[model samples]
Target: MATLSASPNPNPNPNPNFRSPTDQTDHDPESLPQMELHPSSDQDPTPNSNRNFHAVLPTPPEATAPAAAAAPSLLHISFNQDHGCFAAGIDHGFRIYNCDPFREIFRRDFDRGGGIGVVEMLFRCNILALVGGGPDPQYPPNKVMIWDDHQSRCIGELSFRSEVRSVRLRRDRIVVVLEQKIFVYNFADLKLLHQIETIANPKGLCAVSQGAGSLVLVCPGLQKGQVRVEHYASKRTKFIMAHDSRIVCFALSQDGQLLATASSKGTLVRIFNTVDGSLLQEVRRGADRAEIYSLAFSSNAQWLAVSSDKGTVHVFSLKINGGSPGIDRSQSASDPVTSPHSSLSFIKGVLPKYFSSEWSVAQFRLVEGSQYIVAFGHQKNTVVILGIDGSFYRCQFDPVNGGEMTQLEYHNFLKPEAAF
Candidate 1:
């Protein structure tokens, strides 16, 4: 009953235009790391060309026979307690399959004029929301349909003037961002709750649930390089300008303590403190120009993964400690910048390790158990499953790690190599 939505690839390039003081700190160009060549980017004279470069695409597992010929395009993806499922919204309707088994379980052909686009699942209630529309000018206005998986029927329909960019469900309420406005709706009766005028064009929406209380809304504004975290109950707003270019995609940590934002012009993934909007860590990987399309945090918040347009997902481990000593204290007391350490002395550290295979990923999610990360490719229509360790599991998921995978296999896979 879990629903997943396949939206357009927010990151069309792996190198995003990220703006940071550190980016402009002025490191000599000659001191930068050397570029490595990979099969995917052998011709490109840039770093990150060697990251996750595959010589040949692997063969599909025999279990995926039914969908072998169907052009693989991700429509929606979700994880249940045991298994992960991906649905492809095609011309007929939608199809669901198990991530590990790669076997088809359900297929519905609604015959409701093809061109199905956005898909989402209401986690708490197990409802599926589907949007039917495309970019074609001839396409009719977008429409939203809620499907009751228990009965496998369309339970409700909401029509919109423009395409529905993103949707999130919080308890009895549904929040949707379309074009320039955000709408809050009561799920039970489908009544309009509140409509807020958003400054940037709303491209994505994520909600964190608080039992019986209001949820926190995370809105990623297109081309604005801004993310707004609003406490619906308190009506308080925290505006985070993390990236310099348009923020293509972002993901919130499971515990709601950290937020990861990736831009479309640079390769840096910026992590921020959810409570105070402070910069925690700056994770850098890939070519400086790789466009990051999506990002997600593991269930344990120990790991973060970023997917890009160049077809690679980079993973980083999050390290938390009492803040580092003051910059002046670390140096000499006589340093001109030396100052007394304030009460706020601690900082969080995020370190980037390496990236996985190269693929054009649109969106990704972590499974419930945190064993694997699913990344959906906009170009291949295939889901690339990368084990936290390094083993490659080719299935239909996004290219990002869903959450942290703590299994022994993953731990062993990610074990540090001995230094020379």
Candidate 2:
């Protein structure tokens, strides 16, 4: 990607003693207060020109090739564990945004133009895990920078031999994913607790339960199309054969009691009982093969949302009862929105499997071919969609009437002018 030119900074540092991360004096005595970002007319729209406080970090050797012409300006985007907020990694730094009302909370702009490839939040907290990426990186690609927003500096760092593919955070733990390895650390002390070797995971596919008192982690098993689940509380590990092809994408429920998985085939999505590795429910995305970008289960495990390369976001109503630990089955099923099925489904076992497959209850069409991830919003009957093209959408689906979801809000988060 071509570098966007940025004008000189107008809001110079007022504190003479302030220094960037590159300075010998990396620690600050006073903590920086969180300031609500208010983009002014004079501010440049490029992320590098944001008015946020700047940090000077060490520059790493650039071994990667130039970004492609069609590369996304926003390197990465992911919601917090609770879906109340989200983090966007950009070419310069990273920005945090509120998901419900859709507002920019704060952002960090590094003076050295360090592109943050990955940013993982600990549920709208001050601490965030940052991995250097893009054509030009801010830090070494193999290092994970643990940033503390309150202190406005890196609190700790984790170095690896290979580039970090992804990072996941919990209140008590931090999980880092590599090409074929994963490291789990105690968040408070950054002490290594466990490690696992997986079949080549270039996409860094991993999911963890966010519920307290339970630690459930899902990752690729040793065999293709298999999923390994770790039940830390019970000290048990279960492997489930999820599909015929390799596992492409999967998501764990908030409680970790239920799991949703999609294989490289991308047509069928299976829900599993994490405790016993039992098949709970299965739904069909489409008859044709497509790349499954994301899968998410509603907080109550009543509905699941799936996004694919085909440009359609599908929401399927779950009919299984979550009865085990970490599962929340309190939401009454009295009111339900059923997914449409083929008219031939009425004939039991008389036609091809395609005729009996379940379809989406609600659908949202996007620009085909653009990568996007979907998450169930905190708002009742709403789904949040984030596209690599910098598009953010919040759409609400009707429970009584299911088909097309109503668009509630849309924003271009990467375009600074529109972002504000």
Candidate 3:
């Protein structure tokens, strides 16, 4: 079974940190103009092209107390897929934690900087991307400092014209999401590989496929309610007129074979083939409109998870065959579920659209609270939710029945000695 994860929300405008206000009204799905595509020439597949960028490292500032003085506010949190470790960004800096032992690996404090607004780790350890935070930041927000843990110094840096909303690192390339634009750089040399213009993506919504032989980048298209896909290895591109409403969420599978999307309407979620932009399946969140926090796909690409403003998470089943490496022609035939509106009865046809909107197979609900971040563990069939109040919960979902999720662990990282 596959498991997906995403950030959950509380209100119509649930996420105050990243989302720009958008008109959620549904509109006509007129065709969008396609953008020119370019293929990447390097066929090496892996981004381990250059190591010379690490030869000379800039000295780090003199160390003060890297750990928190007492209690530090949690600003942002992210998991390093390269390593099994998850990182919590605090007012002082960032803390790294190992999941297996549930212990703190090390703490990096902002000796001169104000705070760590956002921090992303590359793999297990060492390389990190840090953006300045605080009311009056010590460093320029437009500059991304590349920190090397081994030498405790800056090895390289990438500077942008505007503040970066988010950064995703792969062996071969660095994908940076800006407010309205995206920059793809050759990781080894920071060479400008591609530039993409998008909608007013204040949250910097962008996702990429890893280790999939082909480098694919998915983000908001030039038009609202559209999704743009770039195939780096083959230099091809496909545009999916995904929604008749503004897009609110996006999730890509590990291998870049599938893409999941949600619109501001929040009533339905659709899955598409990354290779050709074919509609694979469409799922529903609810009948009424709500804000969506996150969308994720399992490692195996068989399951999908969605969290929305209703403080509820729904898991949907994808008709993926267990045996075949790719699509199974018989998988859809073996399943009984079909499109929500695929009814034959006469009475059902006269009902409102809400009556035909899809429902989830399994769901987990939390008490109404602040904004929350949600995601599935990279290698485990676990759902991880992080709340604004610093509470963390990890639980497992029963694939057999799509029943109540079993709690595996919980922690409050904000309190002294409360976080593990």
Evaluation by TM-score, superior candidate among 2 and 3:
2
Clash pairs, model 3 backbone = 7-374, 39-235, 47-171, 47-172, 82-123, 83-123
Better of 1 and 3 by lDDT: 3
User: What lDDT score goes with residue 331 in model 3?
Assistant: 36
Best by lDDT: 2
Ordered list by TM-score, greatest first: 2, 3, 1
Query: Where is the poorest 10-residue window by lDDT in model 1?
Result: 13-22
| Index of the highest-TM-score prediction | 2
Question: Candidate order by lDDT, highest to lowest?
Answer: 2, 3, 1
Task: Give candidate 3's TM-score.
Answer: 0.77
The residue-by-residue lDDT of candidate 3 on 1-420, one tens digit each, is 101111112113121211111212211112110111122344212222222222211222223424444677777777665335677777766667665445666665654445667777765535577776656443456756665555454444565678878888765677888888888876555556788989899887888876436688899998989999998778998999999999989988777778999999988899888778888787878877888888877666667888887888777777744322454424334432432342533465687655555556667777553666666754455777767677777777766556667777777766655543
Please give the distance, in angstroms, between residue 413's alpha carbon in candidate 2 and its true position after superposition.
Answer: 1.0
Stretch of 10 with least lDDT, candidate 3? 1-10
Q: Give the residue spans of candidate 2 off by over 4 A.
A: 1-54, 57-72, 323-334
lDDT per residue as tens, model 1, 220-273: 643378887776667777889988788766776544556788777756778887
Residues 248-302, candidate 2: write the lDDT tens digits.
9999988888899999999999999999999988899999999999999888888
